[model samples]
Target: MRPPSELTFRAVALGLLIGCLLCFTNLYFGLQTGWISMMSLQSSLLGYLISLLIPSVSPLTPQENVILQTTAVATGTMPLAAGFVGIIPALGLLDRAKDGMDPIHVLWWDGVWWCCAVAFFGVFLAAPLRKQVIIKEQLAFPSGTATAQLISVLHKIPPPAAARPGLRHRNGHTGSEDGYQAVRTVEAGGDIDEDAEDPGETDQKREEIVRAGWTTLGWSFAASGSMTLAAYFFPVIFAIPLLGDYLASKWLWTFSPSLSYVGQGIIMGFPTTVSMNLGMLVGWGVLSPLSKKAGWAPGDVGSMTDGARGWILWVALAVMCAESVVSLIPVVLELLRVLRANRDGHPEEDLETETEDRLVPMKWVLWGTGGSVVFGTIIVWYVFGSEGIKPWATVLGFGMGAVLSLLGVRALGETDLNPVSGLGKISQLVFAIVQPGNIVANIIAGGVAEAGAQQAGDLMQDLKTGHLLHASPRAQFHGQLIGSVLSIFVTTTAYSLYKRAYPIPGPNFPAPTAYVWLSLARLLRDGQLPAYSGTFMLAFGILGLSVSSLKTWAGLQGKWWAKWVPSGVAFAIGFLNTPAFSIARLMGGIVEFWWRKRTGGNRSANITLIVIASGFVLGEGIVSVVGLVLRTFGIGVASCWGCAEGVCPSC
Candidate 1:
């Protein structure tokens, strides 16, 4: 096996290219069938196949192989542009489109929205941080970990000839005894692959495998499927109806929204989650000995307390305030560090010596970022801004986007926050006061509704994987464009079908953000602003910022409540969604958590559980997608064709 240090840029580059191809293939399938779960599975299989190919021409160390493999997995899973933006437009749901909508193909307006809104923003924001987050901080984005692990496992397989030197080590050593001794003698030595029986021989074998082709493809398939399966299935099974029913049985509130059975089940899942998370904050931060004795019964706090709503609001605000204070301190320190380093430390000047060998040049990153900005701008101008946008305005948007992105990196810890969630929180607060018609509220509300926390979390994980695999900031930035494009279409198509199948009751569900833009034909249309709502959104953003801050502070302070907050949010969203969804999700999470905790995070057991979860999720998702498609065709009558039918029909 070639040592990790010996793995060349060529191998890594090849891995990335193949990974992109594999991911695109999966996306194509997903679009056709409406099943996104294949994303991980396909990517991993491609990565493994790529590893085998690399071995044929060059020797590789296990680490090199793993690193290469990770790049592909991470890049492939990114949410790219798909048909999501087109759904409302295609379905004739937009305010302006009175003509009604089509079912099968995406419209021009949909593409414009994605190109302008998501693609433009995602690329604009993701690019600048490529240097700060991926290079400077060297965060271990986890997507690459899967690749790293798979490569490690495969590299351990014995080579036919043990004595033969395989891929050369980056440290300039070989498989022979003399080289082994020489390698060991060096201080602060390079990594040796524990999985490989003989690094050199393995490298040769890996190179041969790469040349052989089949093994490389096989590995890619396995990893991609495994990753996707785990991600897809686990979330659904965990959110079921059991817990929500119990919660509803106990609590009697006059004003509670008449949620469906599924929605109620989701709430049940959340109570534990929310209660636990909120309880953590109350117990550790509010009631702990540091402040004063606080415990509302270990892990079982009463749901109803004296003035509970008031207490919750006050605690929430306090946590938010504390978080802001804590976050500002580090931000201030980091700013100081930047100023000092730029001024007195003269770090940039000195960087020439170290940067020459230590890191990728900033010039390339800057050039690439600038180029993407230009390309993205032109796309927006052609698609949405057919009449043309002011040069200054476009430049300003790009510039401000960069700044916001940097702030996002520093504050949010990721640059891809959906305006939907932030706005959703604001809508909740506003609807409490205005009691506006569903028409006005639903536009923003619907937008945020489709954009969920899970998607946000997954995006961050993809970013993490990119970081771990040493992908160039430029590559990741560009890759995100690809993913965004794919996602837009996929989401839009699914959503359009949903609206058609089950027409929303209130004032026609307002077109999603993209539809608004597409209707206006770009350049910050007046109606798109929703001035009253925009002001509210600003307040909501502040609220979110506060919430994020408190969560951080509680954790740092070693407060008891930190653990339960996740559960709490889950509960809230679950309660809103469906009782069934909540219960299923909670059970799944509980089981997974228990297994992980008990086994000390054993790899095999975790993988096994994830696989099962993936199966369940995929199965459900497939049925849903098929149902949507069938509904689109006006085939409402239930038949004995697929699983959608009551009984399995024998072919």
Candidate 2:
């Protein structure tokens, strides 16, 4: 028997099941709003609770929890990768409708192929960089760090059988080994010192802690779920006008009463949310109105070429992309500076424990990465050739993706902000220069690069969690593979289902992310920026660069003010998202800061607050997905025309 490790079939299967259920919620919201709740925290809790519920099953081990989250996150985030919401739909928007059918429409299998082709390559890339990024640098991949902490809190009880050989630490024993030493020593036929207290007392104390953790989480979920269900029936509850009903409607200024938004804000935290609000104030309060009044953007609200939204996107991308490149420069140079030292060796490897034995080896990284390039090249040539995507684009896209992903993932690790807009625009520009005028190639190439960036960032986070928990990297890698396979099906089926029931780029689903991509593609295809937005773009780009430089300088000096500086990438997201989103997130941040202060430094209380936020996010997601399934067969509301695509008001 495989010694009760993280790679068990049970954990992977359960994770996939959870991920499948979770995918719908993300798909619904990722298009509806270009954000999805982070699935890691909720899935870890869900897996822990489920392990306890299932009779005769061994309690979920900490290592196994990493696997559970790995699969769940991988599967849950695939819709955006598969391009239902953005890339594919944007492609359709750019290409004229042929006989009233959208070219974005595709069979489920093809959708899977399209997504998986580039996604797996990134997964392979993450393995080699793990030692460098996660271990050596010890950067804070916040979600992964949080997930590891949560798993630790839940698995207070000892593993049922023998513990694995220790993943040796600086003290030659892990903190876990130290904590469980009293119990494990007795189990392993070693004589216990009489002074050592009763092992049963330790178990009892741990049981109480575990009990309290689960109870608090359960109540949070129950409370949030009840409220979410109630709000579902009362659609008015979802929005509370912040600027009065008329102004709220006109300016996209509303306080979303959703706890999910609050939870997201809590995850995002104060500095980031403040920056987002700053962007909203400048973009929505000032720039948008100014542009519209000047007739610079003369089309309807949704028009990409002549609307404020489209004009804002160019300026936002400029700020974000410029900052991403500029900020990434120092980090890239630092890596290059140390490249010789790393090539010689990391002495830390000599200290790594048995856990390293289970890791995805360096050889696999070389073989798998090479294979991915070949595989992706084939995919681009064969699958997308009709649309004008060349094999070279995919090859070069992977090269850019590999380079850019390091920056994106490092950003993700340091700040928990994945700079998707910057990643996409950078990739788009690269392809625009190389494969000029082929919109499909431009878009798909970016998609490929974005996939690498997304997957690389995601996998690095998972590896961080695994490294902390001493989980097998190979096991987590396998979980990622399983999740990727499952994602293809989940994303494809979701696209098919939603497309059948709703217009993708239509009213209810504005596909904010896709619109950005589509509009940018058109400009590149036409070889011109929006008429009057050049000045705005330049001004913001300078602002972003200046801020990045200041922050970087402050960071090196260890200035206290460095932490408070607004992130250029996150600030840019303010333009990408609605003002309402920033308002809600701001409210959530206030709630978190206020509650944390009230907790008076109680760790458990802080955790309980996190549980409440997670509950709200998960509850909303569950409710949204359930309603989507019901409406698929026309089971619920009558004539949801806002959801009825071009049949509705806005589109």
Candidate 3:
């Protein structure tokens, strides 16, 4: 019989349900704000709670929890396949919406199949790199590691149990020989320790940790849920309106007293929050005033306006795209070095352990990747005729996807940032240069590349979690595949309903990412830059290149300043978003900093803090989704004052 601890129906179903909910939530928020919360920790917390409700079922094993999270993340991230809900529709607005020219029109499936096809390649691409990136290189996939630790603690399992004996093939370390040793190495920063002096003492300490975790989870849930409910009823009380009128001015600010942003700030940390604030200052205080003086920004200098902000975005996009290309040089070189080493008979340790059971089969990766490429090409060619997108161009797009996936996964493993948009911009630049004035082809190519890279990065992170729990790679792969398939349907349907309820670019749905894509496409199609655009582009591009160069230099010198240099991409994103969001995030970071100091470096306390912060984010997300649904049905509480005054279109 199969092992009782293996992947079970209950786990899969629970994971899918959680993923469906989060996917729906993502659809709502991604259109409304263009940002989505990570679901790994949230899924673990919710899954553990739901598992407790199953009658006559044994407790969930660490491996089972890993399966649950892997599935949920795959499902949750699927909404990104929508391509920001602006791309396909923007094609219509740009006069390229002909039946045979636009993918959505010809395919007649809202681009869902295209998204799935590209994302499938991501999973296959990530499969082979699991051992090399996670085990041998030991990249710090922070979110994945945290999920593994959460699973271990919640399941009340010892550290040794976290790493399955059957999966112990690392450097010939069998489960019976060094399973505990392996677990000890991975769980060094975690709470558990198998090599403690007293077995009984260690057990007692673990029990205490578990008890504390549960207690913290309960309070966090209550607090977060209550706060979210309060915000729903009294948004004005929770959100402090600032700056110009909400509807009259495209750029508005509101001091949001939401714990959700605070929790996000904590997760993002002080450096990131500070950098975001700096970006905000530059965008609003410095750039807006300068643009106004230049006679292009048609607004009052005293008030921040999106018109001025638009200039910054254009410049930022250019810089971000350039930096993204520069960043890939090292990754490409590293990959080439690995290939040369393997060919020279000095195979990396990961390549040396080529047993079938320990790694994903090479045949599956090659066949799956090849099949996805062929299918994607057919879709592109069918949607857009040879004039719009040649077969070779389609092939080239997927090649870019493959390369970007490798780079994206590596970046995520190191920094917990996928750089999807940056990679997309790279694709857009490449296609723009190759197929000048072909707006339809350019956008499609970029979207496809971004979708592929996004999925690959997500899968690699899941693999990291699986590695930590010693879960079967095959089982995790199945879970991810199932989740991805389900997400395609669920998210597509959610987007449809959301669009019908509140069309994008409306007051309720900003669709920021989509707007960015549309603007870039227009600029490329017109072949004319806005006045002063080149100046700002050159300036920001130099700034980005300089910063990247400095970062590389610092790394080589082992300088302390390397860690403090804020991510240029983060700064760009922050500048593009409303300043109020940065303020809210800063508030959250302050809370986290205080809590950490109060805890005096207690691991258990830190875990509790994370759980609580995650609760805040989850609660806010769920509440916001519910509110949107209610608004869609016209059944929510009385409309807010802004809505009543004709400012909120959805309301």
Candidate 4:
């Protein structure tokens, strides 16, 4: 069985199930609070990484491969989970004709449709792109790196044995031992034409190739697992807030109202730095000194953990999500398309007269695709349209979802404007059309923001990994069906209950971008938000993005500096994500480069560093997972000790 088909099935199934639940919960919270709640499953990317490590019962089949791929693609984009709000508009199921829909209902069902749409897009849109962009361009999509690593292993071989047997001849021919001893007596060397192939050499070459395959599989699994593990754990050790620092920062200002060092780390500028340093002071300086004075513990793990953890965790999560989608998707689709084209031999194009040896069959794709459609239809019918949706509304939602996916793919391409993100935008637009009340508007907007912020980059990579493994894409899709079903039911129910009791306040300003549109819809109903300033900001931002004079100049010049400068500026901006984080990363990169150069490019050292970095990634991810779990239980953490009692501290 293929890697994704066999090993990834259960993992994909469970992950998707959990992810869907997280989205549902977030939707529920959005409705109750009149704002999006960051307490859903997706609130923590690190947590999901950990779950991937746990081995589960996999329904080993080619169909499972598609399920795994679909799950990864869906979760990787994460926006799809969060983007359910967009589906509301596409379906036209909201009661906008009479008045606005309720925020609570919108949040609960928006996610249901959003997930359905993403699953559809992952199959249909990605299928076509597999041939056009990925295979044709030979683009090195990083997401498929895992897949490539797996394939490279399968075609490898081991080294040949050293010894080979030779034919024995009569004594006169000097072939046997006795004849060889009588060197002088041997027959005159007649026809000493040595133009024969060496069996030993050929055997050795075959062995080497075979050995390569085993080595590749072993290494790939290890690397993949290590990466997942690192992402799971590192965040916890470094991402949580220091209790002492929290007390000092917030307590200095207000008693028993300390800030989470980790939370502050996520702030844009000085806040993160100040929060981290303060956390360190509490963890290392205050806590450590007190511990030493009290002679409680010898080591200072507390201080070490006290750095402004949450701030960096959130930012890193954002960056990781973005980088993952950007680097992984196109290559995956391209590779899969190439493999499929090569295997099946495009009949119309007359690409080939024969089919290539394939690990997976085309029938699996059809089955998986069919399965996705069925499951998706069921979800929409049962979940999203279960409300006042007319009987025909079910078909309408599904058809519209398909159409929207196509449009989204065209606009976003294999690289950007992910259908899932677009889904959130679309849902928000629909909510506006229906004019759900202000509460509904705020909830829907929050859902959109969360969806948009999800990592399109990761989804691309997950698909890439599946493609390279020769795993069944259809099976991966099926796994997605299982996961999504579980996730939607659990997360949604939990979040709805939380919202009924405690709702977060909406911002005075509108959501970042698409949410801005949602806010506009609300103005039509309540006229509560500022309109002119939001419009001005939008226009200015678009104008900034539109200026192509510089792009044209660079294109004309064809100068290296012109290209390098912009990239350098971008790097600088990225580095300023967080002072400590950027600095640490820079230092780590420098150390790695220097080590590689010193060792003459020793791979072992590189691998070691990768392992360590992976740990950091995992640690941060786990921390978020904890927060999401807590939120599901209606735990509004205000301080280290307890959560918000429906009071706004920031206010």
Candidate 5:
């Protein structure tokens, strides 16, 4: 049989379309909320819908769907480079840009090309690890597994009559009632039977499932779209006031009923959701109050300003940095073990078996990685050289990026979390020690490391989906390459235009991540630390180590408490985010729990719920894109509640 057509024209075109849409959405939201939208599952759902609507195109198999989503994942994630574009440029506008020395200027072409190179390099690094980590180690890449499940359900074919045994067809072909080919099974010493029971009933059931899925999707889309439009017009009416606004008028504790957050919570499951809520409670309900009582915080508990939160963030960052360093110890030891085994002529044992045909070609991986490295080196040289960075520094940055990219892949495989920011901070500290007072070197090296690590982690996730679905890795690689190239143009253009339209760190668009990056760089450059910075850093650093140690012990001992240890990333996010967002996510998880209990763990019902949740996420994202377009065209919705004046917070 001929191999399935995976990297088809229609698949590539649709993937690019979805990628462009998500790129725009992520760029807008990343600047607005300082968070990037997770795109794989959403893209898979949207891809299924598109394939369903376009009859002119052949229906996609599960593998083809995986290819399409792999492309979108690559394209959608490229907007992370907007941090470099928005923040690095904004630093030039600060008071420090007055000594006849111009800060780094990231031209559109340079930015786009650099981002493309970094993304491709990340994919290259991740490709080799697919079999090792995903297949061999059996890491539970939760998002990828969910995407695979979605694709499998969406494209399920009815079973043929021959599946029941004692039935056969002529010409070695067994066909289902739905006109799709089915696998053939033969009996010993028996002739084929021409007539068999019709499989139409199975087809009918499958059709009902498909129909139900689409119907649920339609309802969810309509509901979320209506809510989004209404929220835009009357934000206050849709806002759920969890805590009354009387305590601190500016810090409104209200949830926006974000369908996106709800969808994310349902997908992330109960453990992550509970941990996120716990983090919020500790950060806001517990720590903030204690700090206020001690006069360590300058504002009231309810109305804690960013300045007040800055102290807490300082502690969070220190904890994160320390955690990253500690986590690398095991990674280094593993690398050493592998090298030792290879050197001793005792080749490492294969832990998992896969068909040779299914594996990505080693030659392709080797050549591709080499080519990407050469191209990336050129791009980094051209981009960083313009900012007075030395050639040696650029090479060092690339080396660091390559190392961190592997670490990021390992972390994602183990935890489903990419500590890119923490990795970036490590790069900054390393470069700070090596090339002190060179802000250009610090930012460029840190950006390269973080960007590469992010891409590596993303590609690893995509590969996990492919592994589960038995998709050809080569085709997926092509899809990723295409998407990464397209994203270079789409994301770069979107970031450039958005930055030109809005002022960074302004009232309307507070590029919070950029602010953090610049603040860290300034501190490193000036060597002027905040008051009592050492005290806070040491305290938090010790606390973080202790937490990590306890979690490790629990895991080693196979204790149930390991599940409740709470992710360090969740703690950082809760510290940085407001209470309302966490509450909204917690509500979604609660609903899921209640639903499961009421339904007695019905599989079909749970699948239906997933479809609905996915639809809500897609609808919200689509509406947000529309809102961004309207704003761009000068037909923006005005804020109903004095959000611009800080009287009410935006979720």
Candidate 6:
């Protein structure tokens, strides 16, 4: 058996195909919701099934499946690293709103290079983390562990049923789902050994295992796409003002039916929805009215400056910043503990699992690490120029990315959580100090850190899966390189396509996360704090820090009420976006919660709705992309609200 081809042509081709699909899928979702879920099982299973479905192609080896996921996962993160979903689009938002400042136009190649600058260093840096985190420490990279177990069972390879995680998100968080159960049904019935089941039972059970998510995923996608399409023709049905026209127009509290946000909400979860609702109450319910009544010169509700929106934006940033910094302390300490406990964080581990021959070469690591930073810095310098970010600052950003990548990898290993968003806050603060009042420098520097952490964390997680399946680290690394090279074009084009379709940061594609980045950059550059905003920032900041600290401490102490505490990240996002968006998402979470509770947490019961929710996201997002393509050749309705109403000036 010719050593089970690890990085074969078919695997790479299919992986690239699925990964590009996901790149578009995730970017569309991430822009609206300010978050993106991991698509490990989604991508891995897609490859496995596709290979199985094809008669001519060989059955997917466990190692080949790992490559499929590695490529897809790596490629999926590019839109974010390239700053399309957040920082880059935010520059457009900041430019449009920030009066008297020269506008920064980010071209297609600029986006590609900007993404390149921020993404590759992390991939190279992740190589060293593998031994430390996955091998010696043997930290549960829970999802990676889950994926390995699933692949083993699927291939009829005897796998240990022990160490299975109970039902949770594909990313290992309990918050979201997308046929998470289908890809990870091992959690429900334990590993499926062929010898243990009845005659022809294994295949039947496998179909039953994946059918709920697999079938519903397609159906729900089509259904949601239909809804989005129907809404395009009848905008009134989509734009319902449940709170009446006044609050809907002025305060952004309308109940506009959007499947994209609802699907995002389902993935984000019930607790996050609660936090968002709370944020809505504080931001729109109370503050917006008060700011206007007190003659704060509040303009439009979504205004970035000299409006009620501007005032809450500062408060949200402060709270988010405080919470992110506080949460990151424990993660940093964990990495420190690993380093201090073991000399070079590599005490000892079994060599049977990995010999010198299978692991990545030392020279490759050194060259990749050194070369990526230098290359990324030059790209940043060339794209943004001195007027944007200086080379010294670019180096600093990438360095922080490398360091944070370690912490990110560590966090993912232990908890299966990637705190890239919060971790990136550290870069924003550093850049604020390095070049105060330089908005472009502030965002791009932060973008570098966020982008690096995201890419590195994702790659390490993929590496963890490879490690478990006895796949070659070298093969996975090369697969990742191919994916990264592909993402440069795929994600950049996706960004441009979406930009042309609608207002980059306008309604429909609110770009909630981008608003988060934009608010912070606007603050650092303008230095104009709303009246009494200092008090608000201070109070909220302290509260955020305290709440996050207490939550962490409570979790350690195993307190019953620990899970009840609001997520600081979700709360900040609520403040950043509209009430309708959060409300729609709340509906999704509520549906999932109802299903889980009604079925008493049965895996099969939850799997159906989870699949539908996933479909809703892909369905609506992909439809928008399709519409964009059709319209380029002059198809579909002339325009939606953005173009029809003169709401989006650029469009």
Best by lDDT: 6
What is residue 290's positional error in candidate 5, in angstroms?
5.8
Off by over 4 Å in 4: 1-102, 105-129, 132-142, 145-400, 407-464, 489-517, 523-535, 547-610, 623-651
Model 5 stretches astray by more than 4 angstroms: 1-4, 56-58, 81-110, 134-142, 157-207, 237-242, 246-254, 286-306, 347-367, 381-385, 507-509, 552-561, 636-645, 648-651
Among the numbered candidates, top TM-score falls to: 6
For candidate 4, the C-alpha RMSD (Å) to the true structure equals: 18.6
Question: What is the full ranking by TM-score, best candidate first?
Answer: 6, 2, 3, 5, 1, 4
- Model 4: lDDT to the true structure: 0.33
Taking all chains together, the TM-score of candidate 6 against the true structure is 0.87
Summed over model 1, clashes come to 104
TM-score of each: 0.51, 0.84, 0.83, 0.46, 0.81, 0.87
Candidate 6's residue-wise lDDT over 583-644, tens digit each? 88788768766766677644345445556666787788678777677657666553455222
Worst 10 residues of 2 by lDDT: 175-184
Q: Candidate 4: deviation at residue 230, Å?
A: 20
- Model 3 earns a TM-score of 0.83
lDDT by residue (177-227, candidate 1, tens digit) is 000000100111123344446545645665574554453333433443443
TM-score of 1: 0.51
Judged by whole-model lDDT over C-alpha atoms, candidate 2 comes out at 0.67
- Per-residue error at 460 for model 1, in Å? 8.5
Query: lDDT value for candidate 5?
Result: 0.62
Where does candidate 4 have its weakest 10-residue lDDT segment?
A: 172-181
> Per-residue lDDT of 524-611 in model 2, one digit per residue for the tens?
7775776678888888889889997887667556576764787675577678776756787788778877876686535456666666
Residue-level error in angstroms, candidate 6, position 107: 1.5
